[model samples]
Target: MSIPGQIAAALSLWIDSVANTVSARLERARGAQQIAISEDEEGALTLRLVSKASKDADLPPVRIGIVDGAISTPLSPEWSAAMKGAIVDLALRPSRFVFRPLELPGRAVEFLDGIIRAQIDRLTPWSPAEAVFHWTPPQPIADDHVELTVVATARAAVTSLSQALLDLGATAVDISTATPGMERIAVHHQRIGGQTGSSRLRFALIAVLAIAGVPAILSIGLGGIVTDSYDAEQQQIQRRIAERRAIARGSQGGPGGSAIELLARRKQTMPSAVMVLEELSGILPDHTYATELRIEGDKLQITGLTHDAPSLIEILERSPHFASAGFFAPTTRAANESGERFHIETRIKPQFGSGT
Candidate 1:
């Protein structure tokens, strides 16, 4: 490989190694407190420390002691005195520091009390373990002894743990509940707290948009009313247009008003047809039988039977009232009567009858 390529490969490997180490440590810490509860292997869950105390064969792997009330342990007494404020709460013993890892059982509480008494006996020769271990509530003792609560257990254990931690050169000891600490450091701290704010803002923006949508829907409903108004206006305009067109058509021309004009024209022409029929009746020779009369436009056709066709023709020709009358169907033998049947058409001119 080239020099640059080899260097890149080395750097990648180094980065991978660091990432794996950090991930493994995080997983170990997450399981730490729960390990002791489920198993007797205390060291697996123990917080690793930087030891300054010389190793001694007789010392137990872990020990316990207690303190009085709350106390402050300084990283540097000079700076602590200079600042003159509480940096953190901690407990101390000879070469050990203590911390409250989690809540302890009642047996653990008695154990802590016994350990503190032992510590007091060892450190101050004049005080007996029982005398140093004695604790009384501020109020008068209701009974000879008051029950030791978890509060006492936590205080005693945490103080002793802090002192034990001091032997290992650990300047600070932290106590945490297993569940809350896991949630706080492991779960919550792994996520971005600021993203939670962004999510909330997004939720609020969606709510605003949803609320704004109502006005748009209302506007659409209002538009429907406006549209209906527009449609009604259009219908009215159309009705007026149709009415005006009808009026103009009625006044304009041929056939003054539809069927009325036709009826009037028929009335004028029908009187003449009646007079022609009357005149025909008078002019027809005897024994001439008329059976059918039909009118086509201005022409009238008469069809009937006649005994003498020549006489009928003579009667028609002699009439000055008739313009021209001619037989269309000449006489032919009928079934009941062997008589002549004929059809005659005539034009009724104005002079055909009494100036009609």
Candidate 2:
């Protein structure tokens, strides 16, 4: 692929990842209830609330009848309301899926998903795109080998069922199957409506493009006006500088008495707080947060919480604005806190643009 095409693909994948992460976080925050719907051999679905504290426990399981690729009886008002914004786990009968036992070296566990996807056509009648499949977690066996059960079904068979649940107001649906004595294995999962990852990616891309286009349009329209204003100001400053330099040369018999010389000398001696803060912000990772920042003369001290405290020293030392970065206080983590509290001290480079 061309560079632009590769960049576009990367941006799409990143958006999808961010969307999925945000959706997961929102789901957790909302405390969405989980409902389990299990299919029987007779094609009836029994819905049960998975939560132990659920008030709906007193209510009996709702039996759903499916016929001719559609729901035979629509959900009642109460059940439909209960299903809204709820995560539904649909467990189909094992008979509906084709189960194949797969054995491999224990080292292949990390790459199980890719390996299974490559072998899907050989293991089942359906191609990878036409099937929804998942495998059980690898179980250790003798001779450094691991075993797993691959569960799969035709995509067409589950599509209608999942759509029916979505129509009943399920926010998300997960399809799975299990044998009598085996653990349940997931087959497919999807968010309902236009809330899927791909949908979110498209929305994010449009929003980003709209944001970026506004700046470009503004720059194009006001480019000449801004440039002309800057040029006029720059010429005025140059003329004044020349007059001051000529006066200094005539009065003092040499240079080093001009305003620009004084300003440059002061800048070289003093540390800029703005530049220090900006440099630190750019150097720190997202997971790190500073609670205290102190600048006394050329020495800088920072107290913060970070996921990895030891790495901060190396990060600060490598920056051009800081030198001799080291921990002044021992790093510690409270039992309830997720990150380590760190205290670090470093010397700030006082000379402006010296690192360049």
Candidate 3:
């Protein structure tokens, strides 16, 4: 890509990164979310914690099960503590989960999920849109065969469970199978009832939308004013470049002169400030310092500080462009620094105008 294109892409990435960082920080500052997971009395995955209005009102429930190849009691903590205002992850028992192993041609492995989704109505008791399913990583069964285990559950069950959690004030809910010694994959239907979005996040989203919508709005209301502005600027730049190129070609082989050539001829008839500065820079000593320089007509004035101030007149006179070199002001020694200040004036020869 061109340098400008790369720079613009980098700038856009930086902007988006900064915006996401700000949004994340604002969300974190609001609070850390809590989530609880356990099996209920009905043997279904749910966020309904056994209540405790009194000790006799309800004894805290306890259930022990092997999760991820380890024996850990999932119901020891107040399921209510885990469920109150937090994103909940509920790992249902493997027995409760129905796993269907599917074998198909290897070519369909890449799009296996989409294929499964397309056949959801035929494969499961639920419709395509009403099924919540998770599939294991596809395993190669043979040379041309791929095997996958799809875990299917009804979306209505999850929706009902999530609504029940929301009634008890859950932020979000995640449903996964507690398969023996296997890491859970967050399937297509991870979160239900939507995660709570912070106000800052909403504001940032609105700002992003507004920024994205600006060109469209401008095209409609201002009749592409920004587009016209860019086009006009681009045309002006192209015109100026073309004008300069034409002038250069004319100077080489044409007759009618452009403003640049007219300026060049005028410059040839007179001394240029740049040439004088270059000549002065070449002759100026390492320790010598020039503070100010002035030129009027064919006369030049130099104000400087130097170790040997009175010797500059000889140096200036040695150059053919300068003549009648003499001190304009009395040399004064600097008190704190080890240099003498001197002001000199000289006649500038217009013959120094040679572009060579």
Best-fitting candidate, measured by lDDT?
2
Tell me the alpha-carbon RMSD of every candidate. Answer: 47.5, 16.6, 25.6
User: Per-residue alpha-carbon lDDT of model 3 for 1-356, expressed as tens digits?
Assistant: 67567545554544544554454444335553534466654464333343223322343334544333233445434554544555555665565455666665455565554567655666667876777787788777654556677777777666565555555556555567644447575432233232233334546666786788778777676767777788679757855765565567568855655665656545544667888998899887887899999999878999988876657888989987788999765554322455666789997765564432
TM-score ranking of the models: 2, 3, 1
For all predicted structures, in order, the TM-scores are: 0.23, 0.49, 0.37
Q: Model 1 over residues 1-356: C-alpha lDDT tens digits?
A: 67567545554544443443344344334432111101022211221112212322122222222234322232243222221211112222211211112212222233433333334433333243122122221122232212221111223444444444334333223332222122211100111112344445445555675688679869998999999899679757855664555555556645656555444334434436677778889988777888998767556687887766556766776777555677654334333454556678775543333321
* TM-score, prediction 3: 0.37
Candidates 1 and 3, the one with greater TM-score: 3
Query: How accurate locally is residue 261 in candidate 1, as Cα lDDT from 0 to 100?
Result: 40
Report the lDDT tens digits of candidate 2 across residue range 118-230: 67888889998999888888889775657787888999889888888888788878788885457877777767643764566669776987799789968977997898799
How high is the CA lDDT of each candidate model? 0.41, 0.76, 0.61
Compare the candidates by TM-score and give the number of the best one: 2
* Of candidates 2 and 1, the better by TM-score: 2
Model 3 lowest lDDT segment of ten: 47-56
Model 1, which residues run further than 4 Å from truth? 1-271, 352-356
